[model samples]
Target: MPKLIEMMKPWQWMLYIFFWALFVTSIDRHDLATWPQFFVKFLSRIVQYTLSIIPSLYLIDYLRPIFKRDNPINVSMKILLLFAITSAVSATLVMLVMINTGWLVYERKAFVLNVLFNIVITVGFTLVFMLYFIRRYRELIALKQSFEHKLTAQNDLIKARIAPHFFFNTVNSLVSLIESNPPKAADLLQHVSALFRATFDGAREISFEEEVELCEHYLAIESSRLGDKLVVNWNLPDDDVMYDMVITALTLQSVLEKMLLNVVEMTTETIFIDITIEWHQHRVTITVTVQLPSKTLMIVHDLRRHVNFYIQAERLRAYFDQSADIQSDVTNEQIVTVINYPLYDVSI
Candidate 1:
């Protein structure tokens, strides 16, 4: 339901409420004195119901996380209970409004089936919501699958990175450097530990500074192993404020690792990677361009690896949804990937 609420646009909400408001008004149109009264009632109900529904929408969204792990049976029962309570409260408020507005003559008899009328209205309103929920069924299922698949991919990638030639090579390098340069080796070991911790941190988001630090740690370890085979050119803003912005966890780490891995696998030649960070109109764009070797372009370009990396990268996209995305351009010479994401609610 949180996902559902998150996915729905403002226009969708307006359309949804407007449709149900008309349905509720129509149910009472038969009792109106004339067509003019019916129209008047519909307009009034639109204003009143829209105002009333806003709070309920917020309440439902607020309660979503609490009920997220509940069983289907419990969820269904809870939904029914909430609807009943909302209807009863709305009915009481409507009755009071009618009395004060001179729409109803105040009397005990005036109460006349108010609860029943509200029950009927609730049924119609609930249907409207159910219909909208049903309409988002495809997207909800896709999102669920993406999350499940992402978890599997992340675990697999983490396992591969943690227990491989790269990890072994870094360890080997650390061992040799321990006697030669104890301080440098210790720093390298710390970076390795921090890199591993960053990946498994279980954080949904982290500051841009942390992300950049992770990237540098990654490159440091890689530089130790690959030596002159890897070259990274960093282009960044002079302003420190941009680094205070936030990005989804591993948003840059995963992609940069994958890109570096792709190049490392193909050749022992010097691989050039340029990473640039820019801030414009309250948005942050990080661009990474990896230069491909002539031999690799002619010999092999593994599409499957790129596709897997893309799938993994898609996980971070869910954080901003429409406000952010990652894009890439592949050519004969290089693959240029740009990660564009917005920064808001940030204090620096």
Candidate 2:
């Protein structure tokens, strides 16, 4: 009994008390002019109603699981039938008790009328409870579906960040480096291994500095392949701030990887890339500016269509519970991508 009561939600308790109060206050006791008479009649009605409701409440609770497993039509019909039978029995018993105790007039017409009123009130209460349960069930289902969708989006974002294309390109670059510069190739392989290990480390978030270090390793591998052609200029926040702030793992790395792939594939000549990360007012903003040749404008457009920028944007939004304004701006000279999201700490 204690466990069952503990399982009842606050709303359920409130509803029960509300109906009890409604039923008690609704009893017609105006004919009892004296205060003592009114008090006795009211107390009598309260006891009668409370005793009558216990069996109905227990029956309804016992049958709830069965009703929930059936169709809505079946459930509604069963509940109505249960209430009708219980109300008829309870009203008959109450009418008999009232007449025997001289509380109600011993008249056939009056007894029938009282019974009918009781049935109506009981059925109304049952219908309200049923509606509340149904609405609560639907809300629970919607919340579950929403939670599932968020999990799916997070998984997709993580998968996109650690995509096969990046690894394939890194492997091809590693092969080339192995033949030309074995020592550099060894270092690149170690970075690649560490990056893959980090992805499977079961951590959903990492410090800002750790993410930047991962990006630097990625850039190092890319630089080995495109040596003189790739020029990267990094502007990062001060060490005190960078080491404290936390973000979704691989968020910046994913953006950088996409930008690098676009630039490396389109431009053959030397291209400059500037990465700027700033922190202000509890926000982190990463801006990547890539200098592209005039001839590669068409290629950049085609690459943009294939990238999963929207997925990354959604991931950030889910993590921060706010808009992660991820935008790309293209011009005749360069392509700039900006990502802005709320800064969280390790405790979060």
Candidate 3:
């Protein structure tokens, strides 16, 4: 149902009901004042019910097509046509019933008054419906704009994070091998160059599956540096749900990189990062959960504040109108981020 129709005043429904009652009463107003009158009223009511219910059913079925545009002129014309057809059909049924049973009554002034009232009622309902629709339409536009703005902000934030992340990981790799072996440090320098090239090569948006590959590449670089200290787990379906769906340019890559940065900065134990994806009827769910360092939680209080992962979540919501949530337990031993996004259908 259109928002306008759903918000109609009780008086509007009463007006429709009154039209049906008036048709029944008017058709049986004279002549045989007994069973014939009752029969005329009953028969008129039957016609009224048919005309009212069938059109409403058809209208409901075809409502999506009708609400394609929000122009007042077009909407008003459509509403008027619908009401006029229904009113005319009801009037005709009443007139036919009156003539059949020899109870016909016609006063020109009263007939004109009745029609004018019906027009007034129809116009009132149409005006209210349009008012509500226009309000909702404007709201949706504002929402879309707000979302676009957030996406732009998030893109900048991701770009800023990229440079620092790249430098940190590269420096960390070299720093780890500084005193141990000159030959190993030389190899680390090569890995750093390749990692930087891979990380900052392009700013193109990729599909979900592609993002996963990029994430794995980043993790691979980190693993080579961290050795057995880092652990990564993936739980993804074996379908094109990931490959066929588009995500923000390097969105998953940035997130995975961010998680790794936090892990490397804080944790030395076997840090486990789990990534999972699921597809439902209307949405795709992505979950990222990681083990928290023992002392870092005490130092930073809330590590989410330090990394600004919440900003990424807000950015995702702005673009998708889906929900993104992060939760940490009271013990602060783990942090979990879950994102739900509407499935983009590109098959057509």
Best-matching candidate per TM-score: 1
Q: How close is candidate 2 to the true structure, as a TM-score?
A: 0.54
Each candidate: RMSD: 5.7, 12.0, 8.1
**Model 3 TM-score relative to the real fold:** 0.55
Q: Candidate 3 — worst ten consecutive residues by lDDT sum? A: 322-331
**TM-score for each model:** 0.66, 0.54, 0.55
Q: How well is each residue in 286-342 modelled by candidate 1, as lDDT tens digits?
A: 888888887655233553336244543455565555657777777678878888876
List the candidate 2 regions with Cα displacement exceeding 4 Å.
1-149, 152-162, 201-203, 295-308, 344-348
- lDDT by residue (177-284, candidate 3, tens digit) is 787776877866765665456445444445777667667666765776777778889999776656577655566666677667766656667788888888777577
Native-referenced Cα lDDT, model 2: 0.71
TM-score: the better of candidates 1 and 3: 1
Please give the ranking of all candidate structures by TM-score, highest first, separated by commas. 1, 3, 2
Candidate 2 lDDT over residue span 137-233, tens digit each: 6776786568558857666657665667777889899888889989988999988887877666543667888888888887887787777888889
- Clash counts for the predictions, in order: 0, 0, 0
Query: Comparing 1 and 3 by lDDT, which wins?
Result: 1
